[model samples]
Target: MKIAFYGSSLLSSYWNGAATYYRGILKQLAARGHEICFYEPDAFDRQQHRDIDPPDWARVVVYDATPEALTKVMDEAADADVVVKASGVGVFDAELLDGVMRRAAPHALRIFWDVDAAATLDEMRADPDHPVRAALPGLDMVLTYGGGDPVVDAYCGMGARRCIPVYNALDPDSHLPVAPDPRFACDLAFLGNRLPDREARVEEYFLKAAALLPDRSFLIGGNGWESKAMPANVRHRGHVYTAEHNAFNCTPLAVLNVARDSMAQIGFSPATRVFEAAGAAACLITDAWEGIEMFLTPDKEVLVARDGQDVADHLSTLTADRARTIGEAARARVLREHSYALRGAQVDAILRDAAAARAADLPEMERA
Candidate 1:
């Protein structure tokens, strides 16, 4: 199947979380012999700042979202078997959504794949100016990256024809265990951008854990955290690249997972890091979240840390043998069931079903 994706940034993940999600899914889909054309706006500055280029597997078409450029690309989108409008394209995404719907051929399937479903829904409910509102019903299907049942039910209730959660998956080939570097090796590590909503949780869980283990080395890697004060034992290495993630994961005794407010509130939504860490056979200590058991079995695969004390307790007590055991179980589970190939297969089935149902609804011209 030929698929066209309209997402935030196909080539850059600097400040774009959604880009990582797109890369994981699209690469897997490409591996399955599906032809993919990714459409991203030419956000030159953002691209330069991030310094990432599109992968070899995808044919990336960069265009201006200006009226003239959009007018030209509309027909190309119409020719695709499936045209997906992903969340967070930055500017005028709602306009892009409208243009795609208006231009798509009658047989083409239109999907609204929400990378940030919880935040999108929250904004939609609170504000009248939410752009996706009018386009929701026209969408043939709605797919989300993170939200659990509540998100799917809410979209369906709001007149969506169908809603599915295609959560994050690991690319085992790209994210497996590797030799650890002494510089990166630490007693505990956390890697995530410093977002306002997650900062408090970081303090409560990460900082508190560091405080508890003053003698133990803790490493933090991510952007937007350059100026944040840290204890002597806590080392901050800003923004580890995607290529370096495996090494980073392998070095950590236990990797901590922190969810943003929206994800925490929505529940059951695992971030890409969770899958990446687990795939790399890194012991995971995640903030206590509802529905976590559905993804990674607690006690067996992951450790749940509720607060500062819980985090400290885990760090101070969980032995290396236990950590390795947990990491191994998590890795086994992900390799067996949660690889990106598995996710691509699931998405392929969903698209096929949607197309079949649409065809069934239409009457033959000869009969008419």
Candidate 2:
């Protein structure tokens, strides 16, 4: 099958959390003999700070965010077997959704893959006239990064024909345990772009934890956090590159997963960092969220924290051997069940099922 995907930058992880997920899934899909083409807008300064070049497996087409450029992208996608317009494209998202829904060939299966399903659904439910909500009935399928059952049920209730969760997974080949570097070594570490939606949780879970454990070292990574005044024990490394993730994860005694507000409310939605940290054999500590057990068992495969005090308690008492045990268990679980290969296979099955269902509908509709 020929697939055309439109989303945020695939070459840059610079403030783009979906970059790793996209690269992993698409690479596996291409390896399975599906032709893949990615369309990304040249905004977001992603082009300027690219972490990787276009992969040999797929063509990455960069275009402007102007109307003409969007029309051209839609035209390019018209002939594909499956055309995907991912959520959080960060460039005229509503317009792109509308254009793809209107312009893709009827035979082409159109998908609205929500990388941030919780936030997208929240907006759609709050506003009756949202473009994505309006386009729900026309979409062939809806895929999400998180928000398990609640998201699927909500989209289906809102007139979507089909909705599926494509939760984030680990790419073991790229995110496995590495030699810990002293530069990144810390008692606790949290790596994420400082976004408005997630800043509060970062403060509560990461910064506050640091403050409480002033005796222990903490590392903060990613962009937009250079100016934030954190605890004396917390060292900020603004914009850690994608190349250094494995080392960073391995170096930390325990890495923290801070759920963004919407994701926390929706539950079951683990961010990309969760898998990455686990894959690198980093003991994981996370804020309380619903359905976390679906991914990792609390206090066994991972640790749960309700507040800074919980984090401080965990860090203060967890022995290095115990931390290593938890990290190893988490890594085993991810390698067994959450690899990109599993997700690629799921994508293949979902597309085939959708196409088959659509074909089955044609005969019945013709008779009617």
Candidate 3:
């Protein structure tokens, strides 16, 4: 299948947190012989801060963030076997959604792949005339990076033909245990672009904990936090490049995964960093959210914190041996059950089954 994927930058993780999610899943889809061409708009200074060169698995088309450029890509994408307009392209998202629904060939599978399903759903609900709400009936399927049953039922209820959660997973080939680098060495490290919905959680779960453990070292690696004041013990390394993520994950005694407000409230929505941290065998501590047991075993593979106090409590008792034990267990669990190979195959089956179902329906309609 020739897949045309319109998304945020695949070559940069600058302000775009979904970069690895795209690379991980798409790479496996390509491994299964599905040709992929990623269309990304040049915006948000992402091109200026490329984390990776164009990868072999997907041919990336970098276009201007203009209406004309969007139109050109939409025309080219219409011919693909699969036309996907992933959410959060950071430019012309509504138009892209409309394009995927209206421009794709009737035979082509049209997917609105929502990387941030929880938030997207929230927006769509508040604004009834959102492009996604309008496009749901016409789309072939809605695939989310995460947002289990709640998201599926919501989209289906909103007239989507099909909705599936393709949870984020590790790319073992691309991410694995690397020797710890000193630059990232800390007791706890977090790597996420600071955003409105997530900033308070970061402060509560990460920064507050940093203050509690005044002796422990803390590192923050992401954009938009340079100006944000932090505790004395915390160090901010604004925008750690994707290349250094392994080191960033490995060097920390433990890594924390903070979900955006919607994701935490929605539950079953694991951030991509959770798997990335697990891939590098970093002991994981995540904010309390529903359905984590579906992915990793709590207390054994991961630590769940309800608040800043819980975060501090966990770190205070966490010895080096315990951290290592938890990290190893988390890594093993994810590698066995949560790798992108599995995610890709899951998506492949979903696409195939949907196509087959459509074919079956076609003959019946013709007979009618």
Candidate 4:
């Protein structure tokens, strides 16, 4: 299958949070003998700080976010077996959605892949004129990054033909246990962008934890957090590149997973960071969210923290051997069931079934 994706940057994680998800899924798909072409806009200085080169399996096209580029992308997508317009492209998203919708072949499986399903759906509900709402009924399927049953149900309610949650998973090839980098060595570390919806939770779970454990070292990595007043015990490194993720995860005694308010409420939505950290054999302390048990066993594979106090308590009591045991367990679980190879197979099956169903319906419609 030839799949064309119009998503955020796959070569840069600068401000593109979906970079890991896009890269992992497409790389696996390409490995499985599918042709993949990724189209990303040259926005946000992403081209200036290209983190990783595109692998041989897929073609990466970076273009100006202009009408001419849209025309070219549309022409390329029209011939694909599947065309995906993902959320949070950060430039002319609505125009890209419209272009894909207009150019996709009748048999093509057009997908609205929502990386931030909770936030997207929330906005759609509040505003009837949202572009996604307009594009929903026309697309063949709606796929999500991690939102579970609730996200699927919401999309169906909003008039999607079919909706599926393709949650984030591990990619052993990219994320593996490596020797810790001395620069990021810390007791607890967190890596996430400073988005409005997640700032409060980061404050509650991470910053407060740092204050409580004044003697322990903590590190923060991500963009847009330069001016925030962090605790003295915590060190902030702005915009850690994708290449440094494994090192960042491996350096910490424990990595923190703080969910955004929307993601926490929607449940079952684990961001790509969770899989990346666990794959690097880092003991994880995540804020309580729904459906986490399905991915990792709490108190065994991963630790659950209710608030800053819980994080502090976990840090205060955890022995080095115990932390290593938990990290190992989590890594084993992800490698067994949550690799991108497995996820690629799942998506392949879904697209095949969707194509078959559309074919079956075409005959009946022709007779009518």
Off by over 4 Å in 3: 362-368
Question: Candidate 3 — worst ten consecutive residues by lDDT sum?
Answer: 359-368
Evaluated at residue 176, the lDDT of candidate 2 is 92
> Which one wins by TM-score: 1 or 4?
4
RMSD of each: 2.3, 2.1, 2.0, 2.0
lDDT of 3 by residue, 21-136 (tens): 99998898898889999999999999999988998888999999998988998888767878999999989999888876687766678889999988888998899899899988
Q: Which residue runs of candidate 2 sit more than 4 Å off their true CA positions?
A: 362-368
TM-score of each: 0.93, 0.96, 0.96, 0.96
Please write out the lDDT profile of model 4 over residues 1-368, one tens digit for every residue. 78999998989988888888888888888877889999999988999888888778889999888888878887888888889999999888998999887887776778999999999999999999999999888999899998888999999999898889998999998998999899998999999999899999999999999999999999999888899999999999998888889999988889999998999998999989999988998899999999999999999999999999999999999888989999999999999999998999998889778878877777655423
Flag the better candidate by lDDT, 1 or 2: 2
How accurate locally is residue 191 in candidate 4, as Cα lDDT from 0 to 100? 95
Please provide, for model 1 over 29-53, each residue's C-alpha lDDT reduced to its tens digit, 9 standing for 90 to 100: 8887778998888663456645356
Off by over 4 Å in 1: 44-46, 49-53, 64-71, 363-368
Instruction: Tell how far residue 277 is off in model 4, in angstroms.
Output: 1.1
